[model samples]
Target: MDRVEKQAALFNLPETIVPHSVLALGYPAEENKEPRESRYEENRVHFEKW
Candidate 1:
């Protein structure tokens, strides 16, 4: 909190608007590679009925 506050204060930015909660961040790691699946083909809904 202290570090973030100090940095925000230096920039003269509002504490309320300062992004304190990081949504997502991480180092790159090996992931299982796979072909992309089709969404429209599987979950198709007609205009008046499925």
Candidate 2:
């Protein structure tokens, strides 16, 4: 998150600890179970061109 220092304090992290990133997981909401379109696109791939 943008506020790493504040977040660290919430978890009781020591001041000396240097945090780069944080991982958070949670249960999905039931309403969000609907199908979604594919994000993959062939044009986005690159072989050797500019």
Candidate 3:
């Protein structure tokens, strides 16, 4: 077992793990500055007939 697993066993906690690739591919670390309303408006497409 690794250090993390060893620590979890010591503290009686489950070993929750995330892959490094996932961490790299996830959202940016910086805070999102764009307003939600504007973003939704910009991305939305109105369907004339559905």
Off by over 4 Å in 1: 19-50
Query: C-alpha displacement of 21 in model 2, angstroms?
Result: 1.1
TM-score against native, each model: 0.32, 0.36, 0.26
Native-referenced Cα lDDT, model 3:
0.45
Model 2 residue 16 distance off true place after TM-score fit, in angstroms: 0.8
Error of 2 at 23 (Å): 0.9
Query: Model 2, range 1-50, lDDT digits (tens) per residue?
Result: 55887766756666776567656746576667666796869996433322
Candidate 3 per-residue C-alpha lDDT over 1-50 given as tens digits, one digit per residue, 9 for 90 to 100: 46656545554553464222211234678989984553446344333311
**Runs of candidate 3 exceeding 4 Å displacement:** 17-50
**Steric overlap count per candidate:** 0, 0, 0
Task: Indicate the residue-level lDDT of 44 in model 1.
Answer: 44
- lDDT against the true structure, each candidate: 0.54, 0.63, 0.45
Clashing pairs in 2: none
Give the per-residue lDDT digits (tens) of candidate 1, residues 7-46: 5665566546563542354545877578557555645433
